[model samples]
Target chain A: MIKIAQLSCGTEYSSVQSEIEKAAFSVGGKMVYPDVGADDIDAAVKEFGFNPRSPQLKLMIARAVQLAKGVYDADAVFIATCFRCAEAALVRNELRRYIQEHTKLPVVTYSFTERMKSAQLLTRMEALVTIVSRKELLARERQTGLTAGLDSGSSTTKALVMKDNKIIGKAWMPSYDVVESATTVLNQALEQAGYKLKDLEAIGTTGYGRFTLGRHFDAKLVQEELTVNSKGAVWLADRQKGEATILDIGGMDNKAITVRDGVPDNFTMGGVCAGASGRFLEMTANRLKIDVTELGKLAEKGDWRNAKMNSYCSIFGIQDLVTSLGEGKAFEDVAAAACHSVAEQVYEQQLQEIDIRRPIIQVGGTSLISGLVKEVGSVLGEMPIVPPDSQYIGAVGGALLSSGFLM
Target chain B: MKKIFIDPPNSMILFDIVERLGHEPLSTMAALQERVDNLEIDMPPMNVTLDDVISGLKYAGIEVPSGIRGRLATWGPHIDEADAAIVMAEAPYSFGCVGCERSNEMVKYLLRRRGIPVLWVEYPGDKEAAMRMLEKTKEFLGGLE
Candidate 1:
């Protein structure tokens, strides 16, 4: 079994230690503390030229030092700290950077809460184990075999077929029925590719309905979006060998993931509300008496300051749009306000969870909305890369990873 | 009788409904009141001790403020005693912070970990959601014998 280094402060006091360990164990990973002596901690701290006030923080730094020096035995690192105090946060980030700089092992960091459960930590654990155990698969530069992937999203179902590193066929539609959507999208993709379902050598699935669809199709792989999306985004954008950040705003939540050389080491998903998601934009379009497709172009022509959409909750956001329109505001300006509201909330709430890196790749269906894309750009002060066929990210991600099974 | 734990312990509305349904309602107000009424070793405003606060470490981390820990200390045992739980999340429970929001999370987490029948609902912002919560709570409590 792969051993993942567990280095964190206050997990024991907070009583979330079992949850973390359980997550690792469930993913076929054994969580172990880097065995370091008291003398080793002091010497490493001195050499590292920093001292932490908390003894827990000091011990955490020492373990990181030992792992970085190759004196400790581990496959991957999981660094976590309770959501409190500036010093612990600094130590968490510093050690993560130090360890990554000194070693090739994948690392993931989390700011845990007292209410944290094993379910919340399982994906991160699974991703770390996937990275450590399947390093060669993630390192593959291209897809060689015929494979199919399905992304059973909350709002839509998407399917794609890839052959020899090329996406030959793809289809997507509203997810009215999970099973029906998956079957229809897959069949559509197969027909477009001029191939039968049995022609595909491997099948993979991802997204909210992944498990349900995976069971239906007898899929070769059922994976989470964190690992699969990063792999696919880098593959499509041709940034497979560099650092990048990925942003995907879905129907119910948003995701911000940071990648290094096509491997996801850090990612944050979900927000407090749906205001930072694609569903909010659809509501805005409905209120404006326009098609969702037309809202983007109309928004690009107006200024958001005129509408004053300051609400970060979905229900209140709809109220704001109605009040603005009720007072004789133009549709174009209101459209811009709606787009800007979603973008700003994504920036303020979700983006705060991860350190932003350049070449930001925005995926999912929301990426096609030029106004949403432009508003997000203005919020971040940099234009994002919306790769070709950005809407099929999950399907493409699933197809790409299933290629591993083919190998 | 089954003991049903209701979150937002200050919600007398929920408390009355739980009692009307013929089950013991385990809430923070009831627990704190029991301790406050006992004159053997406590005063009015301050009923719990340092040991109580430290015992909260069993459920929460030390980084959690002492105020939240003390509140959990009052509710923790009752959470363990519960036959079922009904949580009203993201609801406007009180005008003051009461640290209830955070402690409520810790309480709910404990309830989940205990592996009991849990009915989670959002605080109703409208008549429809309120009716839904009431109906769900009735079914949940009625089935808990």
Candidate 2:
């Protein structure tokens, strides 16, 4: 039986992986559905270089490196790309080139859109499986070991320690420097688990600062932000039998991920709009000269239904707040408006068209803010499942990847 | 010769029209490209750093950074240098690159604040509109020269 590795956005990975698995089984081939947690992040960054403008694109480059390393022992590789994702579209060709150059494995690419039918997906998967099976590839035994997953985000660094397929300890801290913060969080988790770094078999890193932390820690694996988030959401929600949409409002970006059977089925990310992110709330609170922690409480006291500040730009929105204040609008009202605006921005721009199933799982640090959560709930018409320790989902997923759970 | 700033800096038609009228065509894309080339640095389209956002807001005389400021900074230098301006109200929307609606509004706001002769043209949706646009654009460019 041929062993094939799959690479795709976390949102669509589960559904797409299932179809690929069905096809592979039919074609007498085995599928190696592992998260792209391979030790090639640094090499890929060196080869592709970095584009500071699109951090998402840089993550894709790192993913390509992971895939390159992943396919080293596999017979073939499959890359699934979301059709409307601009970042994915921009990086697809380069990712293919990198994988082809580094590995001799046959590579196949499929673009998935919301409009794509199941038959179309199955046909492509079947063809790829048929071709891969013809190569007579052999399956490798799964590796077993304790491992750690670290998430070094722009605002915070998180670390998770996993032993015997269970979370032993996890820690998170506000990030100042990538290396220092990541090490601090890792040490905390390690101390909780009563283990040293040498006790772990592998360390997988993810998130905005993943590349830097991966290098510093000599991590054995590095996964994309979306993939790690999806994995972590599934693990946290314990929704192994059902599908749920994961909404993550990070410091700089917002993501809406669709997960089915503990894997991402489809996902969409907010465009370059700070108003749709946590930064908007932070900036607005700063403009109001109020603490960010207090803004949520103030918003709870105001009438958000009547408070609508429709400015789509965060910079311009601050002016709106100032003008509202000058016009004798209550501070709580302005705070409420800011929260609603952020939620509305994300909903209208990113999640409006997505077919959101039941039980939306909200993750990321911003999810902890009551006002933002309430506003987002209003937009979705359903309360999102904001899991305890929601911000650590990505790191937990990274830990899961490190433990070779996805394999 | 007059220095006429053109919005939607990628519009070769407007650039040609301005140049044919014996005026210098100033555009944000040209200024930005010049800066990028001079530094021999690669800049992804629509990518803005916090510093770029701050500088753009500063250029626009706004004390805060924003998406508008970030975008305005790209063409603010050229806009500052121009003697007059021609704005395509619908051109940026057609190009599908001006993702920020506020930035689009800021361009017009900044141009008006410059206290220069500004020509506002709606991008043609039909042949009749196209003729009218060309005629109005020619009249505006001719007046500048």
Interface root mean square deviation per prediction: 13.2, 15.7
Each prediction's DockQ?
0.02, 0.03
The numbered model that scores best in TM-score is 1
- Note the clash tally of each candidate: 1, 7
Cα displacement (angstroms), candidate 1, residue A232, comes to 1.6
Q: How close is candidate 2 to the true structure, as a TM-score?
A: 0.51
Query: Alpha carbon lDDT of residue B106, candidate 1?
Result: 69
For candidate 1, the docking band is incorrect
How accurate locally is residue A288 in candidate 2, as Cα lDDT from 0 to 100? Answer: 83
Name the runs in model 2 displaced over 4 angstroms. Answer: A1-145, A405-407, B1-145
lDDT per residue, candidate 1, A8-42, as tens digits?
A: 87664344667788889998999989987766766
Cα distance off (Å), candidate 1, residue A125? 1.9
Per-model TM-score versus the true fold: 0.70, 0.51
Off by over 4 Å in 1: A36-53, A84-87, A350-353, B1-145
How far does residue A357 in candidate 1 sit from its true spot (Å)? 3.4
Worst 10 residues of 2 chain A by lDDT: A134-143
